[model samples]
Target: MPLAVWFVAVVAVSFALAYLNSSGWFWIGAGAVVLLAGLGSGAFPMDLFLVLSAIFALCSVVLGVSPLRRLLVSRSLLAWYRGQLPAMSQTEQEAIDAGTVWWDGDLFSGRPDWGKLLAVPRPKLTPEEQSFLDGETEQLCAMVNDWETTQVYQDLPPHAWQFIKDKGFLGMIIPKKYGGKEFSATLHSQVIQKLGTRCSAATVHVMVPNSLGPAELLLHYGTEEQKNYYLPRLAKGLEIPCFGLTNPHAGSDAAAIPDFGIVCKGMWEGREVLGMRVTWEKRYITLGPISTLLGLAFRLHDPDHLLGSREDIGITCALVRTDTPGVNIGRRHNPLNAVFQNGPNWGKDVFMPLDWIIGGPKMAGQGWRMLMECLAAGRSISLPSSGTGYAKLAARATGAYARVRSQFKTPIGKFEGIEEA
Candidate 1:
């Protein structure tokens, strides 16, 4: 964290790299000589000096001992290190494998390759994406008023809400055949940013469905039948969807959810069927209050060993109609007076057919992995884009207020304190 410590670490790495390549002895000669001269100077602070000394000492052992150096890279050493660790939970391992490790792996390795960072491809908008941004996106922003959306109507005007659905704004990520725009994630973020500048409520409304909702999960892990039935409906806004991962007790720690389902026989449409009686209490669901379809995450248990010998099937995701028996989808959460729909929903002993599972019976217990994988786009694109939008609005508002508001017959922006700010 300290500059001096970073400096020493970089130098130590330099020395280690020198020993690894050709002209290694000359590296030992010139770099080591210069390093020793600096250490002899005693100009650094005491704490920094100690750190430098410790690093140099470490470099000595690492470069001096051939066997020690070999052991550091040996597979046996890696295995031993792994064996000493505690068993990883599904959530822990899923989180670690969520996104790509390109830059993170390089930085953590202690010998970063600069070229790899420079080689990453850039993201740009396609012509259709640009045109849509200039056209429908702009029109949508013009149609919605932030004050009216939040305060007057307590939600986006009905016309604007319909416009959002009809325009396929919520279906940006869905494929074309599924009645969605199939836009790139970059375009999705851009759309959010533009809408965010005009209306915070609209930004969230569009963001939730495009991000980690039923559509995304279905796209990644849904069975062919599920995809065929749901994707088009979602893309066409026939169904408003919300995902319930955060329960009353588990918000940020989604994997620690206490909600559960028992896999057993059940009645469905006047017939006996193998399914689950799911019980969940989820709060802070972004669109729960008005969602026609709900995406639920809960631990699945097999006490009767119906599917296999395993008792715990880990976390499973399933699709449930809000109209399903025993489902309680009502009430609302007014977050910061924002008009976007958000609320709590829970169910008690609701029976769900096995086919309702996102990927059917075969993919039960893989819900956490699907969530983590889909989380990458939300983290990188949707949330940040809204933040970017608001940031741009803040800067513009600040500048305009400074120029228009006056103090003693002069613009407030001309004042010393205001100018400094």
Candidate 2:
């Protein structure tokens, strides 16, 4: 390029670069100029030197006797950005807050600390886990008959379901003190991966209790009284547990749930007690039809302001017995005849004690946070492991079918279309 044209282009680039607000250019330019002046001399024009110095100064402003040069973001532009964002709910906020800030910091910086990562020890399963995987896991897979589970029973066979409970499959995430295996997250994931391969129905059966049911909630947020009473029973499979979060209107958006509970006093066992009158309709709840205990999430209201001045306390989760008065259970929704105990459950004016709340009365409106923190584990482990198992099954089936499936005296595997796959 021509000298005059090149100089103008460089000047323009330097002017544009000023908005970036970096100070490194000052040190780099100064070092280069000092080194050049110290080296063997060649005739250099004063005009060129002056122009270069000007360009270097323009490269950065903060280093030029100015304490700060950070360009303040435009208020109008920021307002437009804020307007572009959708209204976030309490559940959404908790979801965002669930992951550690440092987790993203290293990743977003494009230079994750490999030394720190490597310094972290690898997770390994105990002897018990390996033994269980080799024994009960294989036994369960042997009993799985997809045709019978999906069509005839529309669920896992009675014995197979019982075997899952007997093996403590539902209690992997629970602590040892709660009569559970207290397996590490890695072991839990591996268990899901193994179970996912042979039977999706069994996988769902085991995963539901391990992932999102009352057991998990109780472990995380339940009061001491609640934990002592519920955790062991859940771990031992004495009580089948299912969480009711998806209302008909809410679907996957837990925040939009229209199901509600009103704080009031109700007659319980011949005594007037502080409690809530909850009404809810939840669909597609895994193990719902057969669950003994229901963990229900509902918007709580204090119309009488019994707890405080605020009328609307916010979303709260409460444990309700499936056999409670006005409780509706044991209904099935045939979801493509999938072999899992998935169905809808509802209740109208069902009364539960204030103590039934997951974290008791004080945790009212904190259900979303509890759910979010617990859900991160489920989302990471259960979903990915389930998908991995399904993909393996699909690939094996496709490969097997291609060998025999033929047209024009040539196997489908020989065809270009099939070959590409």
lDDT of 1 by residue, 102-190 (tens): 68688887889989888888888999999999999999999996878877899899999999999999899999998999999889999
**Residue lDDT tens for model 2, 1-421:** 3455544654665565565554666555644554345232433455665676666566545344333433333455578899999999666777677646644478887768878777878888789888988888889999986666776777788898789889888888889898998987888888888878888898888878888778888888899999989999998899999999998888957678999999999999999999999999999999899899999999999999889998887888889889998989856877776768888889888888899999899999888777877776779888788778878888988999999998999999999988999
The ten-residue window of minimal lDDT in model 2 covers 34-43
Model 1: how far is 409 from its true place, Å?
Answer: 3.1
| Every model's TM-score | 0.83, 0.82
Estimate the overall C-alpha local distance difference test score of candidate 1: 0.87
The Cα local distance difference test for each model comes to: 0.87, 0.81
Error of 2 at 293 (Å): 0.7
lDDT of 1 at 218: 96
Off by over 4 Å in 1: 1-84, 104-122
